[model samples]
Target: MELLEANGSCSNGSLLTLSCLSHRVVCQVIGNADPVWDNGTSGNSWVTLLETSYGFYIGLGLAIFSSFLIGSSVILKKKGLLRLVEKGGTRAGDGGHGYLKDWLWWAGLLTMGGGEAANFAAYAFAPATIVTPLGALSVLISAILSSYLLGERLNMLGKLGCMLSLVGSTVMVIHAPEDEEVTTLDEMSSKLKEPGFLAYAAILLALCFLLIFYFAPRYGQSNILVYLTICSVIGAFSVSSVKGLGIAIKGFFAGQPVLQHPLTWILVVTLVASITTQINYLNKSLDIFNTSLVFPIYYVLFTTIVITTSIILFKEWVSMTVVDIIGTVCGFLTIILGVFLLHAFKDMDVSLGNLPQVLQSGQQAPVTRDDKNILIEVDNSSIAPEDKPKALA
Candidate 1:
């Protein structure tokens, strides 16, 4: 019986040893699973989520909403400026800043800011290739609204242009590049340092200087292209800066403290400076030119430059198939064509001869059915009432 008890005691000891080993293994696993690992997993999951179809849709929806707001803001701001001008404020070229006091101008400015904010958010989830071209929708909206609300006439060709822009926008959205994974400011910095992008930036700066110092003084008022070129060139840098700022903000919210980086601050400053420049020049263009003429031209040029800059900076086409690239190019061209149509046909209804006809005497008046066969009595006062014609029966 003592031997049996010793064997039973040994078995109990072995069981205890095994249980302790199992407990240590479980503890080691729990200890090794650190927060860093969990955080990395979460980060990856978040990126995956942003790269999904739903994220694209979200970006697209925001872009559409932004376009509408921006379009409406244009009309409101223009109207406000007209009111200010009527109130003895100088024109935009004559150093008139009197629109600052106009409540409608303030409202329009706020609306535009909201639209820009929405656009900035969209850059966080979608590629610029998609967001920029979709801006054509704003032009479309502005054209249609101007026709009804602002009394701008949209001819048949202008209508065709709107349709073309819509089709092009649809195609671009379908063929847009997938969002690149940009988790940190360092990644964005690396992109900015790419040789191609740097060259593009240099060229843009040089052109902007030439236009501002030389061309602007000479042709700025008469040539819409001069002002538009400045805006478009500056716009490229602004868009990139906006994207960088957005990424930094996203990283900061993810517990990364990306805003502490110097690059983030640089981008922030750049975004502010660029946007200010854009607003100043865009307002000048609006004040000088018709909204219908300015918007399409501005959109076309701005979109072209922005897309080119995005492609160079982001290498968005690296992963795209050749067919996709071709489709994107075709879509962009179609949008340009549409813009051209809108611009070319905007004044079709207004005839230069109509003014002369109105000023000329003895112009033929419209004949009514009742007056078709009526004979009129003629008075010859110069003939001393002897040459007067009697009324016909």
Candidate 2:
């Protein structure tokens, strides 16, 4: 008001005449343009953030339920693998197929299949955004169960690593650089037919072929990445295929007969291929690496590749603000650091509780400036009774 009064000469060439632009009305738009909250602060206010549709609730429930099942399945499968080893059968890490005959392993597979089905059903009621992030729950549940069930010791450091991974993943999901597109079958078909995506498909196939045939045969047992890379790289293609297949299925149900289209068959083929490869490698990774370690690393790497592939193929990732970009980079760093911690000292028995003992041991080491003092103490401790007195003298 003071500034307006100081500039008093106004209405000459504006849209409003003096009579129309009332002092009180104009002042509302001038300073306090937005409605203030009850606390007298200007910001986005909401009555309730939880006012979502019932379908969303259903989807959320399904996702959480699936997580528990999947998490438990991981342990069950691991136990089955251990049993297979004890029975003098070849272990999975060593490229053995003995797990197929194990009833316990079959049970785990069935349970995991059910969990995956539930997860897929979730996407029916809710968007991919909500369903995707809840995936970390499986990792958490698996980590918790592994400590007790499998006795894969997730000490204080491992716990911290898990926390970091979860936190980072949450940040990454929240601020993932993406814009929206590809809602319909036509748009998806177009995306699939694009030269860029075709190129991506070709390169991906080549890389995966090499990794699976050449690299996996050599390093599959020794390293986690060999198997996991094949899994992770195929993950993007799997996602794309799943989406395309879902669209085609929806069209089929609507009487559009999309299933008759060659594109639909292509999608079906791609989905089956990608899923087969993913499952095989994923199993090998779980068998070889610590379950807790594998979960977070796999989640992180899969998310990274999915995002990258999204950017390249679907052109979905774009237009992040400066703040969002920074958040994303920080989150990426946190995940990398978490994975590093999980890998680096996985064999070491170090935990946060070990810190005090280390510090105390460092503090307790006796120091002597004089060589004579050290020699006397040493002589007294080492020499016999008569020699001790003689050495002291």
1-393 in candidate 1: lDDT tens per residue? Answer: 122333454332232222452353211111223456432336456654554547667778888888788777766776776687678777543556677788887887787778777887777767788887777676678779888987766766678889998888888887877756454678778888888778889999999999989998998889888887788888887888877777766666566767568998888788778767776676566556554466567777888888887778877777888888988989998988887787656655433445356347445423222121111110100000111000000
Cα displacement (Å) at residue 326, model 1: 1.0
lDDT of 2 by residue, 17-131 (tens): 2334444323312322454443221233221122122545665677678777777776777677768768987645445778778888778767777777777665444444435
Highest TM-score against the true fold, candidate? 1
TM-score of 2: 0.60
After aligning candidate 1 to the native by TM-score, how far in Å is the CA of 24 from where it should be? 32
Off by over 4 Å in 1: 1-53, 75-109, 148-152, 218-223, 283-293, 350-393
State every prediction's TM-score relative to the real structure: 0.69, 0.60
